[model samples]
Target: MNKELWEKAVAFHGHACPGLALGVRLCEFVQQELGVGVSPDEELVCIAETDSCPVDAVQAILGCTMGKGNLLCSRAGKTAYNFYDRGTGTSIRVVARRNTAELSREERRRQILESPLEDLFSTTEVKYPLPETARIFKTVTCAVCGEGVAEHMARLQDGGIVCPHCFRAYDR
Candidate 1:
C-alpha cells in the first residue's frame, strides 16, 4: 500500500488499527484485481458486513461512502466486504481471516499491513448482481413525526404514512 494512502486512511479513521489496515489491504487487492482506482461516482460499490473501524478505510480509500449510497452496511457483524465495479461488471467478496494469536495492537496492525494478500483474506466472486444506483424519491412528511422522508421508505401504520423511525407493529 502507498504510504500516502495509509496516511489518508489513518487520518480519516482518526487512528490506525488492525481493522483499518485490513480494510486498506482489501481495497488495494480489489483495485489490483479489477484494474480500477478510486471511483469518482457510483462505479465502485461496497457492501460491508460490519460497521467497524475498517469501514472508514474503505470510505477513505475507495471513495465508497454512505452519503453517496455506494457504501452500504449489511449489519452481519462479520469482517467481510463485497466490492462491485459497475464499469467492469466485476464483483468480489473479501473476508478477513481471524487472527487468533495474541499480539500488541501495533503489532497486529503491522502484521496486517505487511502480510501478503492471500494470507490475510479470502476472496471469491460475488454471485449477486450489482446493487442499483441510488434513486431520488419524492419526499413526504411523516404523519407521526412531521419529518420529511423518502416515499419509498415511509411505512403505512394505522392507515397513515409514517417514517420508519415512527412506525410500530401491532402485537396481535
Candidate 2:
C-alpha cells in the first residue's frame, strides 16, 4: 500500500471510504491513478505493515488473498494457511482477484477492514441510523360482521379510526 496513495484513496472515500463507498473509492483510485477500467480480475500491489495479519488486515483492501503467500505475513510473520477440503482441492472464500477499486455494493466487507483510515475516523466512532420503517397495514375486522373489513366507506368524521362499514351508523 502506497501510504500517499492509500491516504489519498482514504481521503477520496471521505475518510473511512465508509459503508458502501468502498466501490466508489476504488473506482476513483483506478481512474485517478491506475488509468484503467477495473476488469474484476485485477491484482492490486499493496505494502503491508511489519506487524499485521496480511490476510485479515489486507482482506478488506484486496477483497481476498490466496491465503498461502510464500512471503511470511508482515505483521505476525506467520505462514498463513488457506483451508482446503479433503477430497476437493479448493479453498472457500479465496479472493480470486485484487480489487480495492470497484462498485461499492459488490464489495466484500474484508476490504473495509484493510482500508487505511486517518482522515474520517479515529478511535472515536459515530453510528448512523437506518431509514424510517414504513408501517404495514393489516386486515381490520368489522365488529358487527366478524369479517375482515376495510375502510370502503369509512371516513374520519370523529377522532377515532373506524372501518368504513362501521362508520355508516356513526355518519347517520
Model 2 ranges with Cα > 4 A deviation: 1-27, 36-43, 50-172
lDDT of 1 by residue, 32-151 (tens): 877878978899999988999989988999999998989998889988888898887888888888889999999999998899988888887663567899988999999999999999
By summed lDDT, the worst window of 10 consecutive residues in model 1 runs over: 121-130
Candidate 2 lDDT = 0.35
* Candidate 1 residue spans exceeding 4 A from truth: none
Q: Roughly what TM-score does model 2 have, to 2 decimal places?
A: 0.19
TM-score of each: 0.93, 0.19
Full-model lDDT for every candidate: 0.88, 0.35
